[model samples]
Target chain A: MPVQDYIRDRFFPHIWCPGCGHGIVLNGMLKAIEELGLSKNEIVMVSGIGCSSRISGYVDFHTLHTIHGRALAFASGVKMSRPELNLIIPMGDGDALAIGGNHFIHAARRNIDLTAIIMNNRIYGMTGGQFSPLSGHGIKASTAPYSTIDHDFDIMELAKSAGATFAARTTTFHIKEITSIIKKAILHEGFSVVEIMSQCPTYFGKQNKLGNSFEMMELFKKNTRKIGSNKKLENKNLIERGIFIQKELPEYTNEYSKMVKIAMGKKNER
Target chain B: MKKNISFIQGNEACVQGALYAGLDLFAGYPITPSTEITELLSIRLPQKGGYFMQMEDEIASMCAIIGASLTGCKVMTATSGPGFSLMQEALGYAVMTEIPCVIVNIQRGGPSTGNPTHVSQGDVNQARWGIHGDHSIITMTASNHQDVFSVTVDAFNLAETYRTPVILLFDEVIGHMREKLIIPEKDDIELIQRLKTTVSEGVDFRPYLPRDDGRIPMADFGGTHRHNVTGLFHDMWGFPSNNPKIVDGLIHHLVDKINNNINIIAKVKEFHIDDARTILISYGASARTARHVVENRRSRGERIGLLELITLWPFPSHIIREKCRNARFIIVVEMNFGQILKEVKTCIDKPEKVFLANRVDGVLITVQDIRTILRIVQ
Candidate 1:
């Protein structure tokens, strides 16, 4: 399947910055969706505010570009009504964590059947380089002039603690890994999250003097280590980039449908 | 035929009314004074093969219903003041996109969670202008459970007809108060559904363009045409447009769609206003008190009247100006610090004649409170 087939091609020339990792992550998602033979009409892409939210506007699917951090809530409504339709949510670090963090935890806790793609660009790119929850301590940001005293969130750990049945981490440099992991997350029956540590050469990169887009991609290459890659997570500097967990918990809609069936049964009996 | 009147709460009346009016889905977060609506819906909607989801929060609850409404469902959410506050942003989204959904905000006292379990009609103005944008809204109020039943049906009807979010604004007094309600059968109600587009297949349909009737034709997601629905100002084809001409049309149509149809949208009940000189203007629980005073005063030949507003928004300015023209004075009664009182004054030639009987002590405005105001004005 061609990549263009899954896009509203006219909406291309997307608003992501030049050499921004968001476009690569978006392409990976498009390729994953196309490879799965999913019909764009039967799929709905939801997004919150940020640089990444523009993904919904560009996608040819039934897209909803909603309020900052409310995309998951809106997507839940869509999925609840039309359980047969697949839902995908793409969000940036600040959008998924700072403003929408409550929704993220609760949505995962429900184990709702949806794919949440958290593109971790490390800083607030759209708002002109404010530090994010994923922007680690000692990072420089427009908001963090004296080196941020705050620690960053381990997104995969957050997802797992919040009862996400499928949680994984990959970077934009690991293109094949993100694509395959996204496909796996989509096939998972419960709440699934794929945290892609994509570089933001414009914001985090320039602010921290971490080189350009190419250098930041190299930074991800040097640090990340997939589980069972003969490397242990005991090393504090190493990043884990494999499926953290995939368990068989009942998806939200399916259990709700069971209750629906029981209710309908009582109605028929009456 | 038999009168099937039964004792019920105002919140329960909304459930019965919604079921009768083809309620297909309910997405809400439970809050005090409004939780009963969600509890009953949890059991009833599924039994009727409709969708009900206890969303994670009020924001999601509002967002979810808008999503369901897009796929052709008559959706609703119930909340009190605090929860309704969380819903304001998404409410603006619904208004901006022209989606049809109902929001039942049972009023609770508050600047910030002032009195959650107590009653106050303080949110009347908030329900209208709370969303920060140039837009118009439909707001209905029910004094008792019976009015709650019929007006909920009407709320959904107006939401679908005008394609806007309708507010069923009441208070904890009415919501929790037990009143005799006659639930209508399915065949006995007038239900309105969203107007489906007739634009042909394979042709790119302009989903936001006003049809010949001055209303946009909506095509659901997964319909023949994959038209876009967005919060940003968009063109006829549903694509985001920065063109000045298109943005002008978008903003104008959003407010004008409901403003142009105020006559069909605004609803009020007049009591003894025909030959009265001193009148009391009120809605929701306060109106109940005002009605009692009006009835008693009229019996004593006091020449007093009550304009009970069932529909509070699109503010009904012309109706107030016309109905109260003969009155020497009008007391705007409510459980707030002069919210609707401002709107009442705006509609009258003698703005000074419209006086306010404001109350915000977390108590329902009583008949005595209104009677005293009536005496002072007279």
Candidate 2:
């Protein structure tokens, strides 16, 4: 399928900064959608306020650009309503894990069948380089003019602990891997989180002098190492990017469908 | 959706109303007076392959309902005082974003959760202006179990037709009372879903773009069109901007949609206002007491009238003004401390002539309470 087939033609040459990794992430996401064989009519994309939230505006799907930190909450409702419809949530670190952290955890814990793609571009790019929850704690940004001491969040571990059945991390630099992981995440039957370590070559780059877009992409390629284990690891110790799946308890859909069956007066034969 | 019919309570009537109106999702934390609503829905909604979940709290429940509504599913949540307070923020978001949903506030007495098991009509004002913002709403009240059945169905219809959040403002008495309600056949009702139009794929769908009459169509989630929806005041293409001109334009449209269509939206039940010297206006459970007071006075041929508001917001002020033109006094009886009375007073220039009969201590308004006010006017 043509990329044009899935994109909002009016929002072309997206508002992202030149060489920004969001465009690359969008490409990977669209590719995954195509591979899933899902029609745009059967998909809903919800996003919050941030640089990454703009992705909803460019996708040819029924989309809602909701308030900050509420995408997961909204997506949960949509998923719970029509569990058959494929729901995708795309938000940034700030929008997803920082301000919307509570909703994110609860949604994953509920094991609602939906895919959340957290674009982890270390800083708040839309508001000009403020330190995001995933930003290295001591790194200096607008919000942390002086060296900061606050601990950064571990997106993967947070999802895992919060009941995400599938959790993985990749970057725009690993285009094929990000697409492949997103495909598998979509195939998962419960809450899935694929944190894409994207490049904000504008704000985070200008703050840390990380140079041009290609330079930032190189950093992501270097920093992310593919790991193949379910064991927990300390963020301070090492970093790896790969597919993680935990198919434990039955998903929310199964339970909800059962309740619906009973409500409809269909007696349980068991 | 499977169609079935049965005699049920007013609360259960609300569930049938929701089900027949194609309400596919219900998220609520069960509370007294309103618990049967969720109970009935929990059993009924899923048989038709809808969604129903008892959330951890009223806040999450309200948010979940709002979330589902955006996906083009008719959804609702129910709660009383404290739970209603928790829902205020999301209620404000619903108002701003124009996500259509219904909220059933089975009111109880309260400065704060005064009585959970009893009846009161307080929160009438909170229902109108609970959240701080400039917005208009569709609010309806049910005086008896039958109205509970009829009005709740009306609430869902109005919410979807207007693409605005509608409040089914029920007090404890009506919410919990068991009464004969004729469960109408599916053919007997008219269901209005939010308006959706076919737009070419890949075209930017502005979810908030107003038509000529200032009503905007909502985008159904997962429908092959991209649209931006937000809490901020947005322009047609859903771009955020803070221009005062655009603000005035949008705000005017928001208020005008219902204001222009008031004839269809405003509802009231009037009694014996012809040649009456005084008019007593009441709604919700208090209307029962006011009706008794008026009926008693009428046996002696007293020239008294009753204006029972079925639709509370939009105020029905025009009808109040027109009908009460020759009246000497207007009495507003509510369970709250003069909440709806204030709105009545504001709509009329002579505020002093409008009397208030309030009951704020978690008890139902008695006939004697309204009679005391009526006797003063007499």
Candidate 3:
């Protein structure tokens, strides 16, 4: 099927700013769904409030544009109640790690069957440019005019440690990797986390003198190396990009189904 | 027929009522006085193949149930004063999205974490105006376990009928106290199932468009009719709309859907109100004490009666006006410092006649306490 088949064309042009990386993430996501041959009726795209969250509105799937920081929580409910549906949750860096941090970690801990795509732009693009949890130290934002004192945590590491069965990281510069990683994450039976390093050229780019969208994409290419690449030995600070964790764990809904059977059996005995 | 009766806590009774009302999903966080509902459901839900989740916090619980409700599941969440406060934002989201779900707030002493184990009726106003918006909500309460069971079923029915969140506002006393509840058979009580859109696949399905009966028929999340659901003011297609006309129409529809149907929504139990000179208005656990006082005073020929409110919001002003029309004294009995009393005053013709008899120090308002206030007012 064509990628346009998975999009709701009437809602476009999307509300994302010019040269915003969120649009690339949305394009990659739709291509992934198209490549996987998933039906629109079986896919539920749940998103939180941000430029990235607007992806739910643009998609042809069953969409839920929820409150900030609670997409995973809402997706958990949808997936648990209807286990046959595929849940793809897209969230902004601030929407995922700041207000929604607690729910994010808890959702990973449950190992619920959800594909959480953290569109990490390192800044709050929706409410203008506020420093986010993923905004590394010394980055200037609207809320942090003097540059940030807070350091950013690695989302892949956080998700893995919080019990996510599948964790990966990619950048919008690697468009093919974004699509492939999202496809794998969706196919994973357990909780999956894919942090796509998207760009907010209008905010994080201009505020920090990172030039425009092209320059930011160039930075992503230069700073990140494929995981286990020999170039990582030359530069210890180079961010590694690849699937970090992919193993089987008991998914929440699947385990709950077995428990439900046992519970019913016990009730019959009573 | 063999009677199915169980002497259980009010929280357990609420669970039975929810299951009876076809509740398929429950997400809750443990809080004092309201934890039993969560605890009981965790054991009972799975036995019936229903899903129950103890979410990280109250906000997640509220959001989760709203998500489940969108998938055409009858969903619920339980909390107390502090937890309900945490759920306010998501509750507003549920209101804007018109998700059919039930929220049970077993009231404890409030403002902050005032009292976790004791009863208070202070959340009466909060349930109506807690979510920040020009919107109306359906909030019901009950004085005993039997009423708790029936009212909980009514809450789900109202939620599905209107495609809105229904608040079951029971106090801590009613939640924790044990009482006898006679469980009705499945066919004994009427159950309102979710109304789904008949719009077929490959056709446009407007999820927010109300029918002639003023109900927006829903399409499940994983169904063939895929549409957007957002907290922003949206059009019939459920896409975010900043259009002034769309915004104006959506807000009016959200408010008027519940407020305009107050006659069908209002539920109250009247005792000796026909020829009474003094009428006592009360709800939740406090209504029990008020009923005892009314019965005692009526035996002494004091011409007193009790108006036990089952439905608290949209305030039931017409019923209050009609019930208090012939009464010389209308005393509002509750456990808060004049929460319902303020509403009764606004609804009645004689505001001065509407006096408040309340207790707010974490103790359940007793019959004698109401009598002392009645003596002073009479």
The most accurate candidate by lDDT is 3
Every candidate's fraction of true contacts kept comes to 0.68, 0.69, 0.89
Docking class of 2: acceptable
Give the DockQ of candidate 1: 0.72
lDDT of 3 by residue, B1-378 (tens): 999999999999999999999999999999998999999888888999999999999999999999999898999999999999999999999999999999999999988988999999999999999989799999999999989999999999999999899999999999999989999987898999999999888887898889998988999988899999999999999999899999999999999999999999998899999999999999988989999999988899989899999999988999999988999999999898888888888888879998988899999898889888888989
**Per-residue lDDT tens digits of candidate 2, residues B1-378?**
544545566687777677767788889988877888888777677777878877767766877787788677889888888888988877887877787899998887786867888888777778888988777888999787667777888888888777788988888888777776767787687877678855666675666776765567766666655566666777876655589987888778777777788888999998898887888899988898889888888899989989999998888888888888888899998887788888899887688799998787778889888877777776
Candidate 3 chain A: worst-modelled 10 consecutive residues by lDDT:
A261-270
Stretch of 10 with least lDDT, candidate 1 chain B: B220-229
Of 2 and 3, the candidate ahead on DockQ is 3
Name the better of 1 and 3 by lDDT: 3
The sequence of per-residue lDDT tens digits that candidate 1 reaches over residues B1-378 is 787888988889889889888899999998998999999999899998899999888999999999999888899999998899999999999999889999999888897888988889888889989998899999999888888999999998898888899999979999999989987766687777788899898777777767788866687776566767779888877778889998888888888888889998888899998988988898888888888888887888898888988888888888999999999999999888888889998889989898888689888888778767777877
Per-model clash counts, in order, read 0, 4, 0
Report how far off residue B180 is in candidate 1 (Å). 1.0
**lDDT per residue (tens digit) for residues A1-270 in model 2:** 776798868667778999888888899999998988877788888888899998987887777777778788777787887778888999999999887888888888888898999999888888888998888777778889885678887888888888899998898899999889999988888899999988887788877888898998888765556685433243434468887655767899788877666655773431
TM-score for chain B in model 3: 0.99
Cα-lDDT of candidate 3: 0.93
Index of the highest-DockQ prediction? 3
Over 4 Å off, model 1? A233-236, A267-270
lDDT of 3 by residue, A1-270 (tens): 898888989878888999899889988988899999999999999999988998999888999999989999999999989999999999998898899999999999999999999999999988899999999999999999999999999998899889999999999999999999999999999999999998889999999999999999999999999998999899998999999999999999999999999998887542
What lDDT tens digits, residue by residue, belong to model 1 across residues A1-270? 698877788876888888899989989998888889887778888888899888888887888888998888988888888888888999999998888998899889999998999999988998899999999899999999998999987998899899999999999999999889999989888899999999999989999999999999998988889888765546667888999999998889999989999998787552
Off by over 4 Å in 3: A268-270
- Give the Cα error of residue B366 in candidate 3, in Å: 1.7
Superposed on all Cα atoms, the candidates' RMSDs to the truth, in angstroms, are 1.6, 4.1, 1.0
